[model samples]
Target: MLYAVVDIETTGGHASANGITEVAINIHNENQVVESYTTLINPRQFIPAYITALTGIDNDMVAEAPYFEDVALQIYQLLNEKVFVAHNVNFDYSFLKHHLAAAGYDLNCRKLCTVRLSRKLIPGKASYSLGKLCSALNISIQNRHRAGGDADATSILFNMLLETDHEGVIAEMLKKSSKEQVLPPHLDRASILRLPNQPGVYYFKDNKGKIVYVGKAKNLKKRVISHFTGNKPNKQRQDFLRTIYNVDYVVCGTELMALILEANEIKRLWPENNRAMKRYEHKYDLYVFEDQNGYLRLAIDKHKTNNKSLQSFNSLLEGYNFLNQLIEKYQLCAKLCYLQKTATKCTAHDNGQCFGVCSGIETVAVYNKRLNNALAELQRLQPSFALVDDGREAEELSCLVVENGTFYGMGYFKDKTYLADGLAPIKNDLSIYQSNSYILNLILNHAAEFPQKLYKL
Candidate 1:
């Protein structure tokens, strides 16, 4: 089989925004390199100082060199119908594919990553970077960071992998079903293979085993594999893929439980790649306190971690709207609830809805009693129920419990009789998780759609 072991030095890390400064290709016919090609191309852009420092390729050096378009046809011809090999195959493949397409050439070929091969064949190497791996293998590199030098080094490494692969590991990886071509270079096929096709929260960990991203999926294997399916030549996507070394997951009974677990894990881990959930915060909260006059007062204020809120809202308007409903329903004094700023009696009192508490005609005890009733009603309205759903196993049952307006937690139980007993036994068995507005919304939406699954406590 013919293999085009290729390498390129670029202006930056990503392909879309970056320009290729140089490229090198070595054609190998299984046993040895048959032909070689290398060139410096005018990237048509300014190479960053750090790039120039690393690669020794600057604007002045490539001033009169041919642009990528001038050599696109030659590169395409050399790579066509060959197994495209590279240290990290996708990086070089993406760059060439993008530039070639722009140059009006369609370059399509199978891919082989020497890094993945080394991880399998060489095994137990501390590092697999081009320079380090070459050094460890005693393969000499000429130009170091330059495209031609790295390509030559990679060619020699590929030859060694082919020679050492007695078990036909390379052939196995070349198969369409292997998924080695699309997977992150640092991540192994086994990690993905071991993932259950169940609903769950998956964690993507880096080389040091630090959690970098958290995600929920109804089909864990399908969702996790989807991340590596596309060749998105963006900095964020490329960087995210490069860091993933392992995938770990927790199987849940239902998608709703998976969603809840995902949010909680993201908040707890504070993963670097988790953007939206990390920034999520309940903007407003309903709070109740006693004034010096022994009157109970309610207020909607910005959420504070130190204070416990009766209810949380995503916006101030939502908080006010809910408070308004409580005012109309419980005959609460709008002024006492901080819905009005006027020094005179509140509009509710003028309309005969408020019981003259603002004007001091109503006794504090009576007004306080009414406010307490409203608070009790609000707690009652907060649904305390258990969502019973299909478990990970047929013999087991999954239960998500919310009691007294707060999410208690979730767990799997073998006994179906937990449904008949009170929430106390279920709570004792379940694992407790922090509740957020996002999780509550998901649960409420699920309940609305499938009310039969909901068992009120």
Candidate 2:
């Protein structure tokens, strides 16, 4: 393939925050240079003193030089339909693309990077800076930072790199270039590119722009990528993936932010695809009654009372199961537990299990004391408390709790100073909150140096 060896000097590092200073494009064909263009650009701003010292192209030299728009098309035609090669492809390409877009053009060119190729072909080189590589390989560089000179030096360097392993190197580079699909169907790579590699929540929105799934990720990009890639996912996974057409995410200073955001989103969107994070019906306060003889009867009852239960259970079966296990562990009698017959001197006392609590042999006060002791042991979790953890970003923290008639996973703030920031209730779909199951594991899982603290309301 023909090569357009291009080098550009910019006013500053950021693509959006700066303008181009000088640009040079040298087009080369098989073993010969075909065409080349070089010019200082009127950046319309004072060049930094350091930049002037480096490039030696002061404001005076480019004073009358045409702005980027005047020469864009000329260079476009010259390098048109040719391979866009550069040292650091993203930096150069991003600058060019931004400048071109501002000048009323959108050029999406296929780019190849010599830096990556050098890393693979010539392995274990400490620094891959263009000047460093050229010096190491005995290539002469006339002008250090001038665009024309750098482009010329790059032209020579490209020849040397090609000669190093002509066929083998090109083949590998092409394979890698192929892996980068400029734009995939129904998604913008920008969706995942800038996502911070910290714990946070992400939303999968459908074509109608409605959220379909709410998910929390320790690494948002990687988790989203997993859904898009991989060999056929399971049935449920496939359904979740199908509903997702685009992704929107927030960067939390910490996992705590992600957890809270996820809870809020799920509660709000009520997305069709999310099976988790959505709310579920848990058994409310359990029943503890006393028999005619004052024997404590532990009963599994769901009265829909507002008082927090001993423990939340997903189903009545689970509640029953846990209660039965607790009964067995404490050596409590089924008769006193209200599990079997409605006898007075409970059947368990008759069966030699109950310590005659149903009869006068065991004092009412003593038996009830023992039963209360067991109940206290079983109800270890706080009725209502905030679980404080790290926030999604630096200087941030999280507060998770169930209070004032709601279950909130996490709330965010810019810094710890706002730890007591007033929380606006997060209304999330019951399913969205359920998707945060892993967070429970994360918070409870790590308790060594940083233990998750719980503060009661």
Candidate 3:
């Protein structure tokens, strides 16, 4: 089989918004390069200073050269029916595919990343970057960042890989069922292969072992694989994929558990790629405090991390509605609760349920007594329960405990008799996690859908 060992110098990292400045292809027959092609193209855009600095191919160098459209057919003819090979194969393949299609040519072929091949065949290299790997292997790259130099260097590395691949690693990777081409070049296949086919939270880590992204999945293996399936060609997606060198995961007992854990992990780790969850915060909250007059006043206000809240709500309207219900049920004064702003008596006082607290007719002691009773009732109303569900292993059970309207934590337990002992014993065995309104809602919704799993404490 023949391979088109390819490389390109681009105006930027991603394809959709960037332009290819130069390209080189060396046709290889497994043993050696039989043919070679290289060209500088006018990309119709200003090349950035950094790109010029790295490649030494400035705008002036390509001003009189042909545009990609003028040479698209020639490039296509050279690549068609040949295995496309490159240092980081997806980067080159995606750029060429996007440009070729825009030029009215459909370029499609099997892809092989020399980075992946080197990791498999060569092994134990400190770095897989073309310059670094080539230098480490004592292969001299004449022009460094130039397309011809990189492509020729890559072709030589490919030949070395072919020679060393006595175990047929290349053949196995080239199979239709292999995930080799779909994965990021920096990541090992074994990292993906070891992922469990269970509900979990997965983390994407960079080469330096820093977590860049965190995601939740009902099936860890399936969802992790899905990220590498498509060639998105966007800057964020391309950068995200390229940085991933490792994956870590935590197995959960249920999808709801996975969702909760994902939110908590995203908040804790604050991964750069986790945009949506990082911005999530409970908007409003129900609060109670004592005024100078010794009246225990209740109000719904914006959430504050420093102050303790009676209950959290996603919106002001939700908090107001909940407060209104508490006022009616507990006969609390609307004026004292911040629902009535007028100098006159509150609506609840007009209805004779507020006990004239707004007008000083009710004594502070009497009002405070009733307010204390209302607070006690609120505490009584807060649901304390445990969700007992399937565990990671068959012989165990997963338990999530909610104590007085707050999520306590979750864990797997082997003892079935823990249910008979109640939430205390179960909480002892479970691992603690931070709770938020989003997580509580998930658990509440799941409990509503599957009441059989709900164990009220």
Candidate 4:
């Protein structure tokens, strides 16, 4: 395969924001350079003084030069279907892809990094900078920071790597390029391509068909592609990719539905990568219980599944802190709520914050009435409502159902009759998910952020 050794000077570090000022590409056949192209293009934006000082290519110099738009098509044609070779390949490749995308050319090419190759083939180098590496190898560079000089030096270094490569590392790297799907050995590209470009949840299955990971995305195809193409320098990611042998997905009509499905699936499947959810240990809970006199009392107790807590907290401190605020705001007896222990009237009653229910000075009927109101307010934390938002299409809307302060499910409804008449069809199409602390937090935050979209049904 032919290699296009490339180097480009940019206005800034970010590919999406920066403009290309100069570029050089040297075509090689794993032996010697056959053809070379270098040009200074007008970026059409003011170049920073530091960049000008570094590259020696000021705006005045490029004023008469051709703009990137003039040469974009030609450069794209040259690099098409060729292996992209560069020192830090991502920088050059990303810049080209961004600029070419703006120019309406979808440029996709396999990449070969000289720096990664050097690390494997020529290890133990003190510094891997292009200038330092070239200097150590006695390769002469005419212009230190110019695109042409850097590209030529890189091409020579690449040829040396090709000649010394005995273990087929270079071949393996080219095969793992991001231009195409980087799937596991047992998985096929056709499976990934079949994923829809819509809001959905996707599953990564191992070789034995056991789900290893579950994730949600605004676009299933893009998110799945990002997982395989990411340059994660960790063993966990490598292990995950290696074990993924099959792909599965469920399409959601909206982003909100995707999130709910993701949380539910992670909790249900208990996927290997989703251990964080499994490790969630509920330590404390805000509980409501009845005393011997039929008086309703609230306490922050140690959480238990059988207790069926009204609200759960990850820590005792959090539960107590929240209880303290409720005692102060609702003028409730701290002794009754377990915030203060007392034989007679509580300290809140002496402070005129409580109605003296602990000492029977106030009738249970009057005191219980206020306590029930406070409990009802706290119960409203998770509202019983249906949030209707924009769906994947103009004719539909996504409905998120929370029945009696519990997450029922989510679904898409196309007929307007559901909003005006009945919800039988919408209820039948709902995708149910487990109601846990994580899911509760998500629903609460979204409802608060977009209250106008919520319909309290």
Candidate 2 structure lDDT: 0.66
Against the true structure, what is each candidate's TM-score? 0.96, 0.46, 0.95, 0.57
Off by over 4 Å in 4: 2-178, 280-283, 292-294, 313-318, 328-330, 342-344, 360-370, 377-382, 392-394, 421-429
Candidate 2 lDDT for residue 303:
39
Could you tell which candidate, 1 or 4, scores higher by lDDT?
Answer: 1
Clashing pairs in 4: none
Per model, state how many residue pairs clash.
Answer: 0, 27, 0, 0
- Model 4 TM-score, all chains together: 0.57
Is candidate 2 or 4 superior in TM-score?
4
User: Against the true structure, whose TM-score is highest?
Assistant: 1
Give the alpha-carbon lDDT of every model.
0.91, 0.66, 0.92, 0.81
Error of 4 at 239 (Å): 1.6
Instruction: State residue 21's C-alpha deviation in candidate 3, in Å.
Output: 0.8
lDDT of 1 by residue, 1-457 (tens): 9999999999998999999999999999999999999999999999999999999999999999999999999999999999999999989998999999999988778889999999999999989998889999999999999999999999999989999999999999989898888888999999999999999999999989999999999999999999998677888988899999999999998888899999999988999999988898888999999999999999999999899899999999999999999999989888889989999999878778988999999998898888888788778887899989899988988899888777889999887677788788788889999986778888888888999989998
Q: How accurate is candidate 3 locally (lDDT)?
A: 0.92
